[model samples]
Target: MVTEASETNRDAGSVGDVAARIERLPISKWHIKVRIVLGMATFFDAFDALSLAYVLPVLIPLWTFTPAEIGLLISSGFAGQLVGALFFGWLAERFGRRPAVIACILVFSIMSLACAFAWNYSSLFVMRIVQGVGLGGEVPIAMTLINEICATKGRGRFVVLFELVFPIGLVAAALFGWWIVPTMGWQAMFVIGALPGLVCLVLHRFIPESPRWLANKGRRAQAVAALDAIEREVAGAGQTLPEISPMKVGADRHASFKDMFGPIYLRRTLVVWLLWFGTYLCNYSLTAWMPSIYRSIFHLPLEVSLRYSLITSIFGVIGGLACALTVDVFGRRKLFSFALLWSAVALLSLWWTGATSAETVLIGVTVSYLGITVLSNGLYLYTPELYPTRVRALAVSSATGWLRLASIIGPTAVGYIVAAGELKNVFLVFALVAALAGLVVMLFGTETKSRLLEDVSP
Candidate 1:
């Protein structure tokens, strides 16, 4: 009994020590190395996730697809992502971040390959849903791992820089669609999507399991070992680490789905849910439908439609990069609210103009894309900061599961709205949603800038 009690106290002490050590460590080459490897994996993830949008334009003409069928095909991956996010999130919480991330990478990569061989719309749709599972699971786990490893002072910039690859991936996909899809066919896009599987080997070789997660799980020895490895690298780089402030250690407990809805986390849970849903609803409604709209409504050639869509995606990448640069400077709440408000105004403008000319529509879509991209990508940095380490992956995953939900509904709604010849109403609805999202964040969201994760959420 005496030995057990002493061991427990030591473990508790180690938990607090872990966070302090991580926060005090100077940003080093090791940190950049980790981000680079992880960012590569995420880049491919973005490539695969949005590759379907580009493919849909090709598939529609080849298969003679109806708008509703097109919506279903677009939504299939999101449906899979919803399941993947929740399942992998639980896996990360119960198992570890490393294995969960690797497995998700493998699953998505293989499924992306399978997408290439799909003979019909049904087969392609099924493959997309399965691919989405891996794609959906990767983000929350990746973000959670990055969040735990980063210091509070530069956390926003670090994570956002890491996330910037996602838009880069989208831009790459758009360029591929503009060039490759027209030349080599849509199967080539899936071939590119499957390439990320190679990243799993690199991740397995370099990335360590999050030390904070190990400490929270009471595996103090391993946590110390991981931290020591990172510290040695920082030391080897000739940067002296700052002294770690002693923190009060609490009893370590296992986190559960129930914990997400507990009183302390409930408001954050709801706010992030609204944020994810509203942002994705607005985002995918425009992006997923743009190339299709250009093709069918404007009667543009496939290459020209893709080129226009690519321009909008480039604007999105620009917006995401801008947010990454400014998030640490201006803070999360203010930027998030402003982005949504901007999106709302842009969407309202599009609705008022009635998409009369291709030029008018492109300008409106570009502005809205810019605003929505900031909010959508910035959520990656913001959401994980709102939860404690124990439930951090789960909360982020669950919240993003709402994004998947929006991904599903938004496209399907666009299908019907476009079918009814009321496409302007789509903008009006998304505008209201964006306006509401801005208000919710302004009213209820907490600021996490420069605050330690433990202090912010605990």
Candidate 2:
């Protein structure tokens, strides 16, 4: 009992030492470089994810696909993503984050090139799932890295700024698709999407592995060394270093997978899973289905279909930016509740219109997306905050598995619903989902604003 008590105290001290070291560091040029390097990975993931939505406008007419085939085509990539999220979550925990990140980048980058050469429906289908293994793994791992690095004071804004790269990538896809698909053909986007892989070559040069991760794993020497390097970089950038004082942490700081599924974490797991499922179900359905909806349902020209979709993308990005700026001020729970309820209202408005014309659907979808887009990106910031370092990546990645499931179900449901000529009913279903998510969050979600990660989860 004496030896065990002493060991527990030592473990508690180690966790505090690492958290204090990181929390003292200020925002510097080195941090920006780290964000830039990781930001490119997600920028292209978004670009690649959105690329399929744009490509489908051409493929629907060229390949002559039915509703089921189109839905499966959209869903196939998500199936691979679900695999990537689970596998890499385990990989990041078992191995290290840097290795898992580099491997996923290479996999997706190479597979993206394979997608470019796809000869037919079956060929592209296989390539996308394989490519998705990379795309799905990148963002969650990236989020875990950024969250681990940031000081507690600026974490929300800092992480969300990095996440904003994702929506910007979506906008870039829309912007580039307007010009490129009309001129260079559908193959060009895949070629462009693969370019973020080049970032993998220089990743190790810019950022070090997380000190918190090393500390939690009981590699105290390595964790201190990593923190020392960051301090030197901050000092080199002409910023004064604050004195390190160890924080007080809960004994639960050292965690395992079984502990994660234990009663302590079960409620957190369920709440975030609901947030993940509701947010993405509305988000991907609106984005992936819109171009095809404009082209097929209304018989719009291809350029016009993309242009209308672009308008909504711009509005959605506005919502994303607004959410990032205000999260710290408004608090995570309130902001999440507001965005979910707001979207529920916008989507329900479409249901009230009774199967409207194309322009009306466009307006309602854009309004609905404006709110849902906030949750879509902000979850990257919120999910990581709710877990300790040992299982942070695993937990975030697992929560995002619901996102993969939602993406698959959302678009496929839209496909079947549209095919059945129950177009407005899609908005009704999305509204109910959004509203339910809001109520759960408002009632059960913990407020994590301005707390150290160790304090929030521990």
Best by lDDT: 1
> Stretches of candidate 1 above 4 Å error?
1-13
Instruction: Give a tens-digit lDDT track for model 2, residues 317-418.
Output: 898888889999999999999899999998999999874677888888888887898898889999998888889999989999999999999989988998
> What's each prediction's TM-score?
0.96, 0.96
Cα displacement (angstroms), candidate 1, residue 400, comes to 0.6
lDDT of each: 0.88, 0.86
Best by TM-score: 1
| lDDT digits (tens) for residues 1-458 of candidate 1 | 21222244454326678877787876789989999888888999888988888888888979899999998899999999999999999999889999999999999999999999999999998999999999999988998999899988888988888888888888998899889998999999999888888988899888999998998888877887787777777888888876666676555777877877888888888999999999999887788889999889888888889999899999999999889999988888999999999989998998998877677788888998898999878999999998888989988999999999999999999999999998788889999999999999999998999998888877
Backbone Cα, N, C clashes tallied per candidate: 0, 0
Quality of model 1 by C-alpha lDDT: 0.88
Q: What is candidate 1's TM-score against the reference? A: 0.96
